[model samples]
Target chain A: MHVPTPHTPLPRRPFDRSSFVLSATLAILAVLTIYGFTTFDTNGVDMDMALDMLGDNAKTLFFAPGLSNVTIEGLLKNLGVTVALGFLTTVLGAVIGMVFALASALNLAPVWLSVVVKAFTAVVRAIPTVLWVLIFAVSAGLGSVAAVLGMTFHSAGYLIKAYAESFEEVDAGSIEALKASGADWWQVVGQVFIPSSRAALMSWTFLRFEINFSTAIAMGAAAGAGGIGFDMFMASGFYLNLREMGAFTYAILIFAVLLEYVATKLHTKTMQG
Target chain B: MTILHVDNVRKTYGGNSYALDGVSFSVEKGEFVAIIGPSGAGKSTLLRCVNRLIFVTSGEVSVNGIAVTGLSNPSLRRLRRTIGMIFQHYNLVNRLTVLENVLHGRLGYKSTIAGTCGFYTASEKNRAYEILHAVGLHEHIYKRCDQLSGGQKQRVGIARALIQDPTLMLCDEPIASLDPSAAKIVMDTLRDINTRLGITVVANLHQVHVARDYATRIIGVNNGRVIYDGLPKDLTIDIIQKIYGSEAHDLILADGDTHGTH
Candidate 1:
């Protein structure tokens, strides 16, 4: 009679936590280096000019309370255009990005198609938003359309990459089940994949809005599109409108904070879901 | 009448190791056949080939005498509507309600426009509810699939498959992920479906005892080849040993005394 020997156990490998720490440190250093290079400027500082501007702004601001009596309609009209431009560019970019992202997702596309889409997205994302804005401003002859087009192009590039990653991370088994049930490709996408990724997609959309809003402000400044950013540039150029420049700068900061708060809330809700 | 015929099918991934090698089998109109094998034995591949989920490299597969391999997309979609499948993982869209998941089974029958608009007829919705009740998940119809237990989710999967009103049901390790009692329940449910609906079932099972108990016929596969194909009673220690190799003893259930080999 032959007795069967017990199976040999595989050797255990110890976990190494150093790789995680090293990668994180490298990432932080990379960010710091990029920031340092971008902000590096070797120039003389003028303390007297800065003090004069601040003092003049403080004096004008103290007396400018009565300026609120000027037409409220003008302010409202300016705000309407800014809000519309921001919202429209963000929505258009999100919709177009979502379409391309779905086409590019590795799980949805054939290997060759996925490769083509990834290459296309990489090229699109390599061009910075500010550069796109400058090109559009010069080519399109400087208006709201230029700002909108620039924001849409740049935001679409970033959003397409993010959305593709989200789609790729959807549960493979769910999609396989839908296919096995004989659902057509579109039905599987619409029913299972879209529903499962709804929270992530919505969160991404909100985050994109925040990014697009800032881009819209900057693009408006570059293209001379009459938003808060354009107003800031004009005030800074005039040299006498220090109070207006301060107010516009404050407005931009407030807008950024508000949008960031909304984005954070949306992210929290998506994670909770 | 033969409901499905897989004729000398071959599948080779990367043109070397055979996932399925010249495998041939047939299912009668209402026969329940269980396929038993170890891991990587081409059991799942064979079932997927029936529905063309993974295309076969060569050979022919037909459902109800209609050839499936060469059919166009629309024709294949029509053919798949008639053959329901259940998976070991249940594979329910975790975010969707149980009712919605069941109703998805009707996508093949609905027109593309109607499916996109989600305009299911009242009768179809009624049928979905009826199947949900049949699978004993009527109360959980409104709940998301992820919240359900494994056994309950498998029941919903059964309901979803049943809603397709398929003539032939293919299950790939339907109870492999379940506890022993849950596995029994799932097997009993499949057996009941086969008997009551007169639907042909081709299931891949890991447990030999469950295969013997539920299957009218047992087919044993080893290394992408069908080594034995016969009635459940004919499955012997020698055949099990040949199919499972060194792991043959693992296939034997603790309460396998009924087969008279203890």
Candidate 2:
């Protein structure tokens, strides 16, 4: 390998505590990743099955019997359910999170309260989303209601943390100026926080929507939420129909891509506006 | 009538040292008082305390003879509506239009729900535009603040303050961040507002010559206390030397040519 000329001395920078934490975290992750690779498991080798599914099975997966019926009815209905789950949960999370977000902002509310809220959300976020879904399933029994509530609960954690952080980014002077003008808390929030961080907050909400969408698909399959993902689960597991799985998978990919594209466009528009 | 009566006002930040140590001064209605000080001489802190932007540790700050120290938030807010303040950095919300920023001055007058819903009365909007026109920013009222030059931004700041229809205006280093010509324009606008509307004006200024030209009275501050307070003509070289110390030499160097041209 050709070695490039030794680089010149770079200007020194003061790495903050966060930077040090990030570096330490990355280093630990690298070590864990290397150890995992070394101890790699391919014990239950289904290499032939995987290869056969991707290659020979590709034709049957796409062109199996009842493909037309699956496309019109099965695909549309499940896709609708999956999309609704993502949409409703995200909207609910965003609205609920927004109320708590204001109370959670250090600038807006008391410091102890903000810190308590922030810590509580961090703990909620720490629990895995799948585990959250399963936990809800026990109480509510396996259904779409359980899935929606579970996903919303998890999403509230994400939105609250992100929204409060976004609120914090509003100029300190802006808040002070408003408060000095004799405007109360709600007026101050309406006039300053909403306007100052409008684009940023919108972008964050959209990002949360994107995340919840993917999680919703997973919930549909994992917890019997009756969406495209559940149909996908049935196609892959119970039916033994490879083509149905392929169709469902493609349907999901298309939907995800479209949603992402729309989000990007919307984010850009809001930021510029 | 004395519009401001700050009696032995002492303010300390979180640290033990006083930002304003037993500082006391009073301003009459329609008088332009220039607070001249060196950097970090607690000029900003003093002005902020006057408007109750920051709480005073243990002293009295009475605006229009109303004690500000013990007033509840609602009462303090009502008191603040009559006292307009502009900043060195022109604290206009950058994303909002010049018109929107100016309208913020009228927020204190509106009901909580009305302001929250941004339902400004039609007259309030008209008054905002009139103030913008007074500050020479009416043409650019639709433009967002971030798009404006520093001078234009200060114009928006002035308009925002003016739209409050204030009895007293507290300006903290209003010309500190502007170029010479822009500073001159902002100073002229402030002087006009003081003259035409008879609003009591107290501005912290760096350029001693500008203070001499615009301010009816000059108050020199150093080390968290007032060292001098008198008419601009009565502000002696000895007091300037005492207030600025060695830094007065640099002020002379910067002042002569700029002061002569205007």
Candidate 3:
């Protein structure tokens, strides 16, 4: 069973330059980010206070006695609101992102326009999602409307990059065949690009939906948007109801896992067919 | 009647060298013409110019006496609708069904909305099914195209091109990617399609024997210029050597079917 085959051995995998550069850049970025975070202190806390807080949090996390006070109906309503926000933002982002993605695809759009859109999306992606929500709160006031618009804006930026990359990765031969068929620009996009990239678009949309779900929760907590996150924020920050936070956390984790399972199944099915 | 005419066509890529230099040819209705050449000999460049897939740097190309060069976008699209082009790799949308891929052939004729929604008419669907059957792929009609084998994929490519009801069909190395047996089947299908439809055909071919067997006439190209143009029977061994240079022996004799397999 342990005998070696009398054939040439497989070539050793090389640590390629691009991977090396990637890891090196990531290492540097991580160090710098840690240092930057260190500069913004949350007012120094002694080790004793940290230990006490950790003990209290751990007990609440393990036992979750506040589960008795948590009404299933109230919890379900807030969870539904959070899920709706995530769904709405993802759908709207995909719609708007698709239009911009087409214009941002290198081969499809003119150079100047594509460059401008690409630059704009990069900036949008660079900003944190919570910061975007807070910025919008200043104008639209702290509410669910601001949360929806903020999440949609940031989600559009994320989906734009994903959709554009998907479109660009489409096989050149398929595009060439359509172009030579004398199909107009719109026809080519409608018939060729969209169909060829359908699976990729779906996969990207699913990934963005996961991201938006987390961001929607953050928006609800940070910007006073109405969702389970707002209630959890109150329980943790104002009332210090650790047990309620634990329950909400468990619910969020279960929903996330369910969504992920569904996405993976759909992705595999689409890839195979 | 003449269906295509190219006069002194030259395509340059911002340099002194030309991809196609002074290429001139004319095709009458129902002629099966094959352009044979070595790699990088500009055979593809020449074929692309006839359909205006790539514009020529200088000179003229006309189809049915209409100037293909310098035509407006709409005019060019209208011109292209009448001509069908197939590829070596069988460029089908793999995610689409076999019928849907074939229906794409009519995209040039349909409005953007119709093409987008895939509103193939009843007659068009019937015609596509018939074409699929003709290509011996009727059972695979509903299957996604990626499920097919290489030869079967190319058959779908042929059916797609045929659905356009094209007057002129241009094939760029259609059999290059296929295996020996698959190559023979594809070549036979192309030959049958040519004879049955009486459509004028222009094909780019790499294999000498395949072109000689399938093409009524062959044009040899080298260094972006035509070196020989005559009936396939008139193509001498010496001429083949001249066209392919040092690579002729390995390419033709090694295939062991220089006299045409089928």
Best by TM-score: 2
- The sequence of per-residue lDDT tens digits that candidate 2 reaches over residues B1-262 is 9999888988877788888888998899999999998887888889888878888998898898899888998898899989988888888789989999989988888889888878888888888888888788879988988999999998888888888889999998888888889999999999998999999999998889999999999999998899999998888778888999888877777764463222
Question: Local error of candidate 2 at A228, Å?
Answer: 0.5
Model 1 TM-score on a 0 to 1 scale: 0.87
Give a tens-digit lDDT track for model 1, residues A1-273: 975567856659776689878999999999999999888664576767878987876877544522132233644465556767778887998999889888889998888887897898798789887777778888887787677788788778888888888899898877877777778888887887788888888888778787776776676667777766665566567444665655555555677788788878877876555
Using DockQ as the yardstick, the better of models 1 and 3 is 3
In model 2 chain B, the worst 10-residue window by lDDT is B253-262
10 residues in a row with least lDDT, candidate 1 chain B: B253-262
TM-score of each: 0.87, 0.91, 0.90
Query: What DockQ, between 0 and 1, does each candidate earn?
Result: 0.56, 0.71, 0.69
Clashes of each: 0, 1, 0
Q: Kindly list the per-residue Cα lDDT of model 3 for residues B142-248, writing each as its tens digit.
A: 99998999999999998988888888989999988877898889888888878998888999998888888899999999988989989999998899999989878
Ranking by lDDT: 3, 2, 1
Give the per-residue lDDT digits (tens) of candidate 2, residues A1-33: 985667967669976999899999999999999
Better of 1 and 2 by lDDT: 2
Q: TM-score, chain B only, every model?
A: 0.95, 0.95, 0.95
lDDT of 1 by residue, B113-179 (tens): 7765566899999999998888888899999888999999999888888888899999988887877
**Residue-level error in angstroms, candidate 2, position B71:** 0.4
Which of 2 and 3 is the better model by DockQ?
Answer: 2
- Looking at candidate 2, what is the lDDT of residue B25? 88
